[model samples]
Target: MRASVSTVQDLGMPAIYLHLLAELLNTIGVDERALLLRVGLDPARLKSTDLRVSQAQASEFVTRAIIESGEPGLGIMLARELKLPLHGALGTAVMSSRSLDEALELMTRYLTLRAPHLEVSRREEGDNVLFNVSCSMDLGPLQGFIMDAMLFGCVSMGTQLTGSPVPGAAILRRGPEPGYFHRFRQHIQVPVRYESREDALLIPRANLKLPVRFSDAQLSASSRAKCEEALKQLTEDAGFACRVRRVIETSHPFPPKLARVAATLFVSERTLKRRLQEENASFQNLVDHVRLERAGELLKNTGMNLSQIADVLGYADAANFTRAFKRWTGTSPSHYRSQALQPIKPQASSMRATA
Candidate 1:
């Protein structure tokens, strides 16, 4: 089956970051709107604060942006523009944190909410504490761009939060230096080392005690709470089975074929099956779950008959739909609908009424 761009699920980087990237592309005369549209993304929709673009689409857009602008340092440039507040809840939490260490810890724990592909870990080396940056997946060609954004973005945000250059701070990159880094070297506050063992931000232990410019105990607590909720939702949605279920739920044709769904997600049939199996799920089960949920809604809320509901649910006929519904709920669809439609009576309280 040919992949349909419209069927791709939205479960990746925040749209606000993409909006920022678009603005950057425009400044460089790259026709950002066209570029986004070329990849099936709506330019206006990218402005939403709570929207997410599909990982496949985002990957394609960034790849194209790099090729079109002839600048491989786009991620580094984008990092310079990523102000703290622009990061949403995570940003607010970090800004209001009591100390630089607290802020880093907040980011380490909640980075998945903003960028699901990256993770931050801490290590001690002499007087410096290394906040290592690593990709949670195989990012392929985008590794350099993502690393530049994450590591450099951390450096920029650190300085912004503390209101000064962090003492004894530097960036360590794993591979030989990219030629593009030199272009932005003068603008960067800290020295950067290449051919290092890991991509990390090296900061002195003393720097961790530095006070944040916007520290607020109350706001930090509130913002951290929001970040916690966002992380939970992101983790739940990050599951392969959950992602497949979402695709099934939103599919236009209803109960899309396994082949088409695999295509839409940019994976082969075998790979999709394997991934779902790893999560102890099957495509048929996900589709059936969605069908059952929709069936309940239709049966209870709509006046449509069983045949109409069956057709809407991709069932061959009412008999098959009825049989399936019975197998699932141990009752006939008509009986369930009748029960759902019956008026409810308030039950008397178990406790005695007050005089």
Candidate 2:
């Protein structure tokens, strides 16, 4: 079916959890590239570490894939791929650990990088460590599902880290589903509040200082710096980043950048690039991000032909655009376009699950 660019403008950014969901889709025989286009992305460009995309794009793509493929909780279905001591094939890594605190610390550290939205915080009070969860605001829906996964992941990690039963530690937020609680609650027999101030777990603080089986001080420091930079950039200029991003909200290739964009901004290319760089951004990056951001909107709502969509992004040819998509998502243009034939659904709780 043909897609209409105008229609996709209404669809917003995707939720963070959806990216994990897309990874999960691979195990279930879903063509991830087709899924990319379904959410308005060209599967080729996902490789640029600096390139940015919106949560809406991820959500729209997965949602469309689910509807078209008739799959539910596509993210959960792919849990086997994760490396954290949570749900994947390697989950056994945390299953036998030296101490409970070390297990919690290791799982928290690993998962934070794997799941960007799941913010994990730790504080010490003598031997017990107080852990707080601050979810990424980028999460739209699917927050509940991710949250559920975290609960179990936490329990599993704690058990694995300590090599002992994870006690029913007190939790701050509303508890899990009755059946879920019943199945996983042996170690979690503590009290839970309906609406607590934060989503956190109270543990022995001494546990945090305990070294993990896998230690990488250098890598941890490097990751911390990168995350800090991303956060700083996103916090200070995300408005401008998002504003400039609207230029290419779909998977289409970027236009040769109108000499007129500078003219309209009342500056020279040299001047614009200089100013943007001063803010630590480049014009091309903004254009690419807008394309990724828009990709989600387009795939979820539009009916423009893939070729037409390519043209809208100002690509000279569909093939060039397809190559770019493959870089981003490991798929082609037409296939990504083909994935956008369904409606997106709402997520559970404005409170995200991953974080």
Candidate 3:
């Protein structure tokens, strides 16, 4: 499904999902406290499943864990541990779905409750149905992990509901096979093709018609209604900020004017400002956030010079871009780029202080 532009904002993932990750980290002997701290997340705050963490925090934490644990398949490992209870009403609705197809539909519709950054849609190609997954924002290094978790989670959950491995199922991943490719055979029980053009799950159309063992019509209806209500509330509470941020991030020629953004959102400039204030954000702040993020990505990944980066970010000159970069990161763009590119060196004492 094509997610509405409103869903593109960086609202965050639910704490329950993070809780699962923390549990996985703890199980694997990783320092959960240290990991949370690295991402500026409070361990105490995650105790409540009702809370949410910013996408930046979530991505950083995942990246740190991946680096520290050396587990390239961390996402799949986490998905293996996930249970339906963690997903709230959406899980309930999925469990009560009459068939696998209905469950998939419910999952696609309510995925925002868990992974607001992703959009899932169904398409038919010949004899197979493809559940395509796309992201609304740039996930950067977290893309593979996130995609793995989502696709594996769906398959895992489908198995639970059907009491059988999903028949004629396969996975298509956009990136290369990870070092832990063996784990896919151990956990997925389905053919996985990496380095594909898209990230999707391929299921025979016949499997979509298979009945869910736990299907209950009345319960499914009630749970679905609850999901709808919860989704509506989530959208109202967090979507405006995300919408504004999405607009800023995707606008051509870099940051669009506040009035233009307001118009795109179909609200008056005054109302837009007021709504953003209510969400503890402002237009310029959002613009700066997008610019800084784009700037950092360009600086680290592209050979673009300062002036070119500035031009891409809508700045009149490299001087203005340097000033903004320093303001955002406490270092000039050139300095930041140099630091990022520098190779790590051992301390003299560790290197035997020889000479």
Residue 56 lDDT in candidate 1: 69
RMSD of each: 10.7, 14.2, 17.7
What is the TM-score of candidate 1?
0.69
Candidate 3 regions with alpha-carbon error over 4 angstroms: 1-8, 239-355
Give candidate 1's error at residue 180 in angstroms.
1.5
Candidate with better lDDT, 1 vs 3: 1
Instruction: State the TM-score for model 2.
Output: 0.47
The candidate scoring highest on lDDT is: 1
lDDT of 1: 0.82
Error of 3 at 254 (Å): 36
**Candidate lDDT (C-alpha), each:** 0.82, 0.49, 0.78
Give per-residue lDDT, candidate 3, residue 202.
93
Ranking by TM-score: 1, 3, 2
Give lDDT for model 2. 0.49
Query: Clashes per prediction?
Result: 0, 55, 2
Residue range 213-310, candidate 1, lDDT tens digits: 89999999999999999878877676777766655654546667788678757789999899988887788877877777778878987899999999
